[model samples]
Target: MPPLIDHTTHFIAGRWSAPDTATFPDRNPFTDEVVAQVAAGTRQHAQAAIDAAHAAFPAWAAMPPGQRQRLFLAAADIVERRAEDFVRLLAAETGTASGFARFQIRWSVDLLRQAAGWGYRPAGDVLRSDTPGRFAMAVRKPLGVVAGFAPWNGAFCLAWRTVVLPMAFGNTMVLKPSEEAPLSAGLVLAEVLEEAGFPAGTFNVVTHGPGDAGPIADAFFESPHVRSINFTGSSATGRMLAERAGRALKRIVLELGGYNPLLVLDDADLDLAVNTTAFGAFFHQGQICMNTRKVLVDRSIADAFVEKLAAKTRSLPMGDPAAPGTVIGPLINDRALAQVRQRVDEAVALGARVVTGGRANGRVYEPTILVDVPATAPVSCEETFGPVLIVQPVDNPEQAMSEALATPYGLCAGILTRDAQRGLALAERFDCGMVHINGATMAGEPAMPNGGVKDSGWGRSGHYAIEDFTEVRLTTLTQGALQYPV
Candidate 1:
């Protein structure tokens, strides 16, 4: 059954308009079906969204911080109230399982709550002065207008992460959501703000295509109103956006692709390690950026670990995401499916062994595992962005760490070890931005910081993501006047 298309108009200035000849159909990847039709916003609409955001920024930035915080809290409430609907719609659009869909909905709510805390907090620091009455302090303030470039994977969550913080900090936004799955969920997220009495233009969703993004980004960069951009997507595209943002000297918070690693030490609990790795690496059909792509095991336990991991992966549920007990689902589309297949085939031809699953049917690629993979194969070096794991054996932790950090990508890394001190030590040595001890690389808590380094991307998310969306301005309030540095 096809999901109903809700909220088809471009949401600008707090109203919806199905502008003439500016609408597009949004399709579901699971069945290659058009589930929703929404406005395919033009460059004109993008300009309008930016203009509206610019017009509203001053008032929003000047509003009482407490009031802004309360508004965001209310938005969080609305999000929670609509959780079930959001999960269902998200599953339909992105082919995410129930558990993963629920996680996305919950994370969005948590991010809103976290962002709310930043709203009223005095974003300033006091400085010690050399002279009496020479009071000096620096305060963090909202960046005027924000352009949020969201991708299709975890679409609502990514959009929520980008916008909630910016909005909470009093910056209005022109959000360009991915055209692949812009329907009920993401649109409804923007609606919650409007419904919660947020002023029109404070938040606007500009519906458009990938091609449309270049123009929108260019305009936002040129506009004096836009202050920053928060983007979550591929490194190639992220680099382009970062370059443009840099040219404008605009701030950017980017969370890009990953070829993250999961290291299983000899002392680790085999059952726990196998279970977590199987689920973590294959979840969402390996579409997640943080999914464990490479598994480095201590040579002593390599064979046993692979046997258990392969069996666990083979048992994972597949097919319809909406169906109960379905742990795996189809890739986003035919392109993604083909990419996964080609990578697996090429890796095998280059001396990698497919211990299990290297097949594709339509958009569904079997949860696959490849062993003895060369360090240079795309499966090992690049972000396959599919349900495939490459396993390699190392003689010791030193070798494991060395091989793990061999790739230029360093988004996230996971270590499973019995020794706490060893885990912490290894965590510090890993080149990635975030490290996980005794768990899969995909593990994330809404309250915890997330992101990566190197080619994996820049910036961080989670509770502190709001800090990236803002700027600091120093202010001095002196009673009866005072002094000079010179």
Candidate 2:
């Protein structure tokens, strides 16, 4: 057996400090075994982390751009070297299946490499001066301290995304990872950065127990040293944080819940559409914010599409995440499994027909497909965040687009059609931030402007995130003394 890893101390100010509050067992969702002993951080720890980041900000921000670039590159290399360890940790800590774990590792490496190039990007733009003998420019400066809250579902990649770009742009960060994935989500990044020779206090991580996030969030919002906040989680939590951030007069970037849609037009390739819908709706057990929650198919092809998709969903393997053939793993906890059960049961009671799987085996909810769900069903409108796919027939392409737009969520949409021009035309009508033609809704890249609109939350990720993490200042130099009209 591999040696057990211990993560019972918080990484603060470049040192491991035993928690003042307590230590909690981070358990494997699949086996119910202790994966690690995680430190339970208090509000004081959160404040200390913020203070350390604030103290480290000036030197990190002022360091030569080349140096920052080298550090990011080194970190990427470290992540690549430790890929297997990350894969194991992800499975043990967050129930991440092998395929998704590998994807996370690759995406994290890409994010780090992309962040390395950010240091060399143009930091300011030269502007044409309106006044003679004057030079004017808009300079982007790093925010002093950034507070990041990363979720457990996409622990490694999402956590890396939360802090990497902002830190690349020269801001120091204090990350508060989800209690369910403290090790994989936050402390692992801290380890990589520390090994990559990041300075003391440049990146800090504090872990809290379940239901104890309030103190840490309070600390983040109440502290004057924290300049901005970035969060990835449920829409409800995002709303609460947005309100708090607003009251505190701090800038915040939120990537919240998504009821993403997938449209299969009449002319869509049936095989491709079925495969895309199955993968988009069931991959990672449909826990991803970009997972297809609602599939709108043209009535002419709806029956065929649903039949193929149901077969595909039923064929997916569900078992231990660490197993080579497992495509579906246990939910994060019993609460998640219960929520999935409640939603599917309620929908079925309200006239939804289960086309395929709709039962729970322990912590794993079977990959489910539903049809004829009523509009009033909770599963019809809200995000199920499980392996539940709702297939609805649309009269035509126009009705499909209209049905897709009925939701408050505007995170992402996918269009599967053989006609490229038709797909493009339909893509233009989506209110989502991202629309994929001939692809699954589960899409992301290091450089893409990945985000959402409407109730899915505001702001963007990837290269666009720099704008949210930094501030712009207008600077001007006068070649001669200014003439004042008195």
Q: In terms of lDDT, which candidate is strongest?
A: 2
After superposition, the stretches of candidate 2 with alpha carbons farther than 4 Å from their true spots are 1-6, 19-21
Off by over 4 Å in 1: 1-5, 477-486
Clashing pairs in 1: none
TM-score of each: 0.95, 0.98
TM-score for candidate 2? 0.98
> In candidate 2, how many Å is residue 395 off?
1.5
- Candidate 2 on 1-486: residue-level lDDT in tens? 463344457899999895465888889999999887789999999999999999999999999988998899999999999999988888888888999999999999999998888888889899998899999999999999999999999999999999997898899999999999998889989889999999999999999998999999999999999999999999999999999999999999989889998999999999999888888988888899999999999999998888888888888999899989899998889999999999999999999999998888878889999999999999998999899999999999988888899999889999998899999999999998999999999899988999999888988888888789889999999898788998
Tens-place lDDT digits, model 1, residues 76-169: 8988998877777776788888888888878888888877777656678998776666678988878789888877877777778778767777
Q: In candidate 2, residue 473 scores what lDDT?
A: 94
